[model samples]
Target: MVFKELRIMRGPNMWSRDHHNIIAVKYIPEDIPALSAEQFHAVQEYFLLNFNDQQRSEQNTLSQFKWTIRLAALLQDKNFSHDLASPSPDILYGILQYKTEQGGVAALETAAQIITALVSAKEPVSFLNASLYIKEINLRNDFGPSTKIIVEAAQARNIPVQKGPAGYIILGQGENQQRISAARTAATSAIATNIACDKEDTKAFLESSHLPVPKGVLTEDLSHLQEIAESLGFPLVTKPLSGNHGRNVTCKIKTVEELIAGFS
Candidate 1:
């Protein structure tokens, strides 16, 4: 088995930021026996038998194994392309998206390892070892470095810290319960946050308040993009009307061709 790629995606992505941290792995299962209906069922059974342990309930483990089998089946089906060439070789791919509270990357990696073990029928695979590794990783990442600092500070101040669903932390309790998300507090202005989220809106608001802002026009039309770029002069910036963290944003667009490509 050859792993083609392994990546850990963090922050806001296609998946829910509050709930999911995805670990994506692409591998070629050349060493594994040919994927057949019988082989698929055997792999599924093997996964159920070997992967269950004290770390997770049997039901949850079965659920995860089912999902892995589905992915494997999807990849095994030759009708659909996995973005490879038409005459592509057989490939096995899997993605594990774990809840931030459940261990995130650690859980994802363990799941991938389980799938690999089942597919290849590899021996010396210990669920106990995997469980312990996941536990260690969970302990290390349960409270991220920044979150740990905040948790410690809250503890020092005698604020009751309670873990909430999807990586949220609640400081204090009952009516006095204050939610803490990274540096954001319960009192953080929702209107301000929304305004800050939209780059064009933020620019407009700042300009209205006599603050300096980049001169840019927002348009979805590619034809209009060139016109707007020409009006603004060369070396302009192109970005999605509403986005964050520089997603789909291209800067220093100096020519019409560059603007067109940047917009696309």
Candidate 2:
């Protein structure tokens, strides 16, 4: 099988409006020829017998095989589902439009790999590794610790929650709506954001508050960086002045060479 392309639908799209967060994967079954119903059923039965450990269905349609593998993968570790699948006439054919909140290419890609594994089960594929891969995908796309807590807490109270842009969680609807992203809220001021974002300014503010902060210096040139390294000693960290989610951060430098590379 050949995977052609992947498209992330962030908002209202041709496939779905309600379920906007989706991964549209274009794939092709390589070396596949037109087949009779019996041939197709035989192939499908072979796959089901391979996964005899899991529940199987008799009917084998494009969507059924996809959903079976999808559910099987979901049970392997995390929750996964799709809104629908469609066929295309263009070069990029056989669209696997799967719904995913966090994973981009992972969900569809994993499905394709799982199908390949099932087909290769005759020679005994690495089913254990495949299951682990699915679990890893689930964990990879799961919400952060704090974010998950907030989401679960809201759900306990029967609030309507949806994923928001920029790693936020939206609760309720219309006038009663509220948004939370980690510790920040809609009422968080721009000033507070600035103080938190700029590492230099944040250190200064914390120091002024008589709080201990990590010893580091912000630098824009090689000379300043060298000065910081020499003064602060080895085993240092480097990062952009203002960034989030470890965007440009590099850590644990024990040598000048590594420090220079990290800064660069």
Using lDDT as the measure, which candidate wins? Answer: 2
Per-residue lDDT over 102-190 for candidate 2, one digit per residue giving the tens place of the 0 to 100 score: 44455455555555544444332344654566567667666666667776677566666777787677877799999987657799898
Winning model by TM-score:
2
lDDT of each: 0.57, 0.59
- RMSD per prediction, one decimal? 16.5, 9.2
**Where does model 2 exceed 4 Å of error?**
1-67, 70-160, 165-168, 173-176, 181-183
lDDT of 2 at 203: 92
Q: Which residue pairs clash in candidate 1?
A: none
TM-score of 1: 0.37
lDDT of 1 by residue, 1-264 (tens): 334675554433343333223445555545443554544554556546654312222332233343342333222221111222123455444555443334544454454566666555665246567656666656655666566788778766756565777758887778988786755677779997788778888998999999998787878787797578668998877888776435587888888999899989
Per-prediction TM-score: 0.37, 0.52
